[model samples]
Target: MWPEGIGTGAGSLPGADPREAAALVTGETPEFPALPELPHRSVGADMIGRTAGLLVDLAVEVVPTGWRVTPRTGRDLRRARDLMSADLDAFDDACDRTRPGWVKIAVAGPWTLAASVELASGHRVLTDHGAVREFAASLAEGLREHVAEVAERTGARVVVQLDEPGLPAVIAGSLPTASGYGTVRAVRAPDAQDTLRELIAGIDAPVVVHCCADVPPIRLLAGAGAAAVGIDATRPAFTGATARVEALDAIGETWDSGVPLLLGLLPGTAPRREPAIADLARTGYDLADRLGFDRRRLARLAVPTPACGLAGATPDWARRALALSRELGKAFADPDEVPAGGAGPA
Candidate 1:
């Protein structure tokens, strides 16, 4: 749905000011501004904690071993809901002031949430297929309500992004057990795809699956009917011959299927130094060229994003990063703004 090169954050800004974060996003990305995620506020405000509020008839409590399922609603779950309500209020205020067109909201995908949360037995919910299914159903219903509320409050179209940072680990069987002495069994690709597919189908709005890992199962996600697959443009290099070859193939397949790629071209964390806009834009241009697509096609098929979340960044850098990300969007929209060679002028 991006007309010009639209800018968006990966998720998670640096501070607790949802209003300020929302204001920055609305100011920079006029076309598509996302609800800013602020994990630095700690406890229930983190991605996992905030999304826990969406589960139907489910409750979670923070433990020494992270978040564990509870038999009934507890303070932890209440805290999560309270923080989420505050964020929404802030977002509503910001939207009323800025009047954005379309706003994006992020939640942990089924796979990621299941991987992060623990059952009453102290094992990950992903370890139990039945639990996973129930969690997915709950999440689907919760997100529907959340999205409808957001749209009604802001008077803007709502788009949902499912952050699946743990999907790669789930597929690879890399996550440790609650004891940390063993790894959980890896999920097969087909099963993973099926779970995600069903989950995406339940969401009422457009869904973008975000996974910042080096190998994010791009083809599987795109095939699962994700409108967009978000990945880190820098961490996942396209220069190598092994994984890069497979990644390139996946990118081509996803694009060929009419799916947009949310490219993380800008730094999310503080960079060693200020980055040149052309340098970042060139990453997308080069990627397009590698796939034998014209640079101009990137405007239609890509959404510029930060390399990852900005939770670890300085407040100043976070704002600067968002601004830079917007500049990259403009460059993608018009290559002449910053030539593909990555240098502005002779």
Candidate 2:
């Protein structure tokens, strides 16, 4: 699974430079570096496009609205493959010096992919149960090959992070149809969990299920065999009196089970006034106290990160955020070592 006191990104950085992104992430979060996803690079580099390119037999092409299934491999699919290959090369080159023991790579989870991609009929793939199953199987096969290649290239154990930012919308039936006139039918929780569990079981590596939504399905993901669950602890839906009791209970139970949490506490974008590492880490510290866990338990159960992806951040803020995240990781492991007032502005 995950190492104690580790920090990493939620994927997607600000720039289009793969080499730079790889180097920055490896340098900043060496203990648990993640493969940088640069959506700014264009269609192929985006979360959906990148993951779509990994499909075994399925092919997707970009339409005016978005990506849709195609009968055959198209130029869009080819370009996506090219971008992903170049990124892998960049990651390999960047890690040549550090050779981190563990590396993370993210892909769109099955549910999100289904909800986002459209079939030939202009309906979401999730609308067809058979198609959904087929896509999941293809994705699983693709991921296995992708993992093997990455492990071979970097000589490190690969950690698969399944990004499910769309799962909440899918479960709530809030995702608009292609026509935008109606919503897709809500998916049953049990069905979603089963699909996710099968996908996780298919992959060989330890899986981390990430969902930055206001109300991430923590209980379902945890039960589906995620080695770790990623969420934004600072999200309004997860904190204070406004937070849902079910969400709070799920988080507390997740920790009580000894499953590490990739807790997002720092701002992903630039703040008006730069805060100290101590200031940024307070959310996590306070979360531990409120949950009735000893502060030291954070060292074992929490890994600090930005609230979400840094794609919208300025280049400088992105780098600073990663550095601060690393610092917070160290602080989690040794709170006494942090300065009294706070470390200066990152």
Candidate 3:
């Protein structure tokens, strides 16, 4: 079990009037703090800029794009590149100011990207395996360059996380069939596994794949050489008590395969009571026990986190959640002297 840090999706950027987005490339706003902020309409660059400004060691970028290429396509790409570069600069400055162990950068995985990013002919590249492979290779190269930029700026090791919410869907053949718009074809498990392995092999950084959906192709992910798999543990896809039991068994098997699991335990919404710290600890312990792992291993394998990002939460709630998470982590590490049922000093 690895003692990985808890993670959240990118936080909101500092803005004018708590609603106006600052130009990511050129804004005079002070570096954003680690706490959450008032939600303002923001683009991918704004999110990345603010995240980097906050000194977050790791962040993910989800740029918006049309199904078909638009008039501002080149501009959008340029903006994205510039924003990423700026974030790398910010990351470097943070490393100089407050050194951290490692930094992470995440992007949508190739298969999911192929499904989402449409071509000029209004067809998803997923239909063409050759094109999809090429797209994956290109993305890998782009990500490698980005990783190198971050590493050069920060002088810290880089880890790449690939967000693949659509993986389970693709495996289950639930993704819509390619019709006249495109030929929708399901990727075989082995082929998908090989493609992911190639993508990971191409990048120099350690790779992690995140699926907020059901237990992903766990064995496949492990086989693909991913260091870890992130899943929404609090709200698992299995139904009923029996299914839950079975799911735990499966997770244990996956762990046995050597890929550590990053179990998400935080609620999507922030909790009201500070005393919820105890509940959080208990939840972590319970999940570990059910998964056939020892409670002591909890601090190692389990990264207590909100089931998802706090973007939808109010600023107050998000701040509270982060504070609570840090506090509970401390408790998990050393609980003997801490008060058993109180919020303590979060």
Candidate 4:
């Protein structure tokens, strides 16, 4: 379902020009490319805004509280759709000259989307069972059409990366109500997994679920039928010397089960100087060693990505970070590329 290189975890350069961002994505990550998400542009291009564009017959408008469902279309909703459309146009043109082999597109997953958007009554959509099912169905339908359109224009196999950054909060019931007096009920693991399964069903594209949270449900995501689970590998859960047994167990189990892990190894910020590719790639190498997988297995099972979105990075840093990541991908392919002694040779 993926190739061996670094791909953007969906969001790109710090500007409003979707074309420049999209074009940079195409130019930088040749191993695999993704549709650049330009959330820095404004409200509409953010994760929630982009996913809102895909809601069928449902409209979400920005309010003082956040995204709220509306009975009729509104300016906020229109802006979201317009920015999304412009992104598509920019992406189409970016890929026009030389069609890509594969392109990953990101949208908020069912649980995250439900948790983020509010209903007409000012409560989260996830609070209502019927609304949850409805929104998932609408998202599934809308995604199918969106993927088809992207495939038509870019001539690349479209891979969907469902960003579930809010899933942990949803499962923990940490999200406060609009009034901030109480919290929403925590969703059971089974219910959350099943809901996600329904959202991805029949979508007809390989799917990757990205959760950069401290406690992303690795096994649950696999059970939900995600082809790959993107995680923040730099987090203590995965990297600390005494990283919790649960994290180790999950990593071992997921890989042993033949599921790929989209490892987030790059920092999404500007370092004083550009780091060496091997220096940047050491985490993946060490991870493979820790998990007892052969060095070569890293290339086969791991897809490198930024620790999170690059929206906060300067434009120069964004491009450089991606370029360095592509090199990390190459290093994954050639074990000797990292040198035997230490993080790449001096």
Candidate 5:
């Protein structure tokens, strides 16, 4: 779904100003800009809260622990909705003069949302199969409408990015229970795949499944019919001397299957040392080398991204990181053109 010389941010930016955030992302990655997510605004603007705003009939309220399912819509859900509405307004205005051909919008995947929100009884929604299924259905229907509205407003093909940062924990049963006394039961790979598949099938546009875990389920995402898989290449599972053989093998297999990877290569926050364009891109090159693919294949098979969200970054670094990611995209397309010096000070 990505174009040449293009890169994208991983949803969240550091600032609270939606107008500025939208302008910055679009100005930096004009070809395929993402709808900048400003989590710093408030709890409603965070990943879970933002996605919760897209529920059709269901509503959520913030509890002492986190978001919880509610019988009736409350102030928390209203605030979330208002924040989302404002973002859409800001994004629409930002693109008023010249709209991008494609815009990526990120939402929490079913598994992540289920794992995050608590039920009325205080257990995770994922703990009850029926409740989770209902939420997924609501999300699917809501997303269809949301996508249509964005498409109409921006006049661009909308690409849905399902951010599943919680998927690994769900698969491994590592999430603490509401009581924090025991772990939830592990979800079977097949079951998880099936739910994801159904959700993807429901969406009108192509879906990119993003999981920035130490070892995201590349095979499972591919099996679930993801058009692209987003991964953190800087993680030990995918890079460095300690990289896992299995992780490399899975990544190689996914590439061999012709599913492009959204490779997270740039630092999300300010690095201790400034890095050259070539330096920041080394892991992607090494990954291709280890996979036995031609170095040039990276240009077509990978889309560069920051290591994760920029919520923790300084505003300057966040902008610079997106700019660098775009430069890396060009470098991947033509390795000979890397600039001479390091990317300037943090």
Candidate 6:
């Protein structure tokens, strides 16, 4: 794992400065740099413009269906790609002129992309193994170039986060079983693993796989050579007395493979203050102790992020949350100065 601080979503930048938003997302102080304020904009546009401006070096913006290409919609997917690419380039420039760090460019993983993208026949590409493989290769190539471009602009490492929210569902065959969806086809575990391995290998920087759902293919992700595995920390998979053992098993598996875990501790939508900070640290330490991992290694592996992105939050809340994440990160890194048992910063 990269052993960095918290990361928030590109919070809504509508009429808000991009630099400030970028700072918020990357845990930089508010006074770092201001960005262009884009008000009342679409989420996709807002994410692209604001994230690029935040000097994140790398980020991903999910375009809603209106922007996505579908046979039924007859929308030009190329146009969407062009717009996203341009925004990334602009963001890359902003990073060069301002903050310098690894730039992260993200995209939906191939399986998720196939699950969502519809062909002219109204069939989901995910059902077709051949088609899915092709899509995965295409995405890998595209991201490879995108990473290269971001690197050229920022002269920093380019990490690619593969967002695969549907991975668990697919693995469980839930996607195929859902009504209105075609026959449930299982993805061979090895094939799925190989696809991700190839994608990660093609990238120039360390790779992280993020899955917010329960019982994600953590072992598979590690085998694929991912440097870190990000999962919801507040809502871990284990419950009851079995929770501790299960948690340890999970953490041990990842750590044994030398893959650090990014513990999602922050409640992205909640108020941020001392209480929140205390809660986050306690949770981090508790998990570490249960997992039998070194507190220091846990500190380095534990990136206190929101359970997910904060696009749903208010601007003020998002800002405060970002600040709290940074503060808690400092405390986690140096527990002696910031006691985990304390009631947080007053």
TM-scores for candidates 1 onward, in order: 0.95, 0.96, 0.76, 0.95, 0.96, 0.79
Cα distance off (Å), candidate 3, residue 81: 1.7
In candidate 5, which residue ranges exceed 4 Å CA deviation? 339-346
Cα deviation of 226 in candidate 3 (Å)? Answer: 0.8
Q: Per-residue alpha-carbon lDDT of model 6 for 1-346, expressed as tens digits?
A: 3435434332233233444444444444321221222334444343322222222222222344311223221123333444455555556556655565555555667666667654434556677777676667767776676667767866766666676777776666666432465556767778788888987897777877877666667788878888787777666464325464555687778877777775666565655443556656777777767767766665567665556666566777666656766676776777666544565423
Tens digits of per-residue lDDT, candidate 4, 196-314, equal 88777768998888899986789999888888888988888887485777887788899999888888877778766566766656778888888899988788778778878898898
- Identify the runs in model 4 with alpha carbons over 4 angstroms from their true place: 5-12, 340-346
What ranking emerges by lDDT with the best candidate at the front? 5, 2, 1, 4, 6, 3
Instruction: List the candidate 3 regions with Cα displacement exceeding 4 Å.
Output: 1-73, 177-183, 237-243, 272-275, 335-346
Clashes of each: 0, 0, 2, 0, 0, 10
Q: Please provide, for model 5 over 276-312, each residue's C-alpha lDDT reduced to its tens digit, 9 standing for 90 to 100.
A: 7877777778899899998788888899999789999
For candidate 4, the C-alpha RMSD (Å) to the true structure equals: 2.0
Quick one: how many clashes does candidate 1 have? 0
Measured by TM-score, how close is model 3 to the native structure? 0.76
lDDT of 1 by residue, 300-328 (tens): 88888887898888888888888887787
Go through the candidates in order and give the C-alpha RMSD of each one to the true structure.
2.2, 1.8, 6.8, 2.0, 1.8, 5.7
- Model 3 clashes, total count: 2
Q: After superposition, how far is residue 340 of candidate 1 from its true place, in Å?
A: 7.0
The lDDT per prediction is 0.86, 0.89, 0.56, 0.83, 0.89, 0.58
For candidate 5, the TM-score is 0.96
Segments in model 1 whose C-alpha atoms lie over 4 Å from true places: 239-243, 339-346
Minimum summed lDDT over a 10-residue window in model 5 is located at 337-346
Pitting candidate 5 against candidate 6, the one with the higher TM-score is 5
> Candidate 5: lDDT of 335?
71
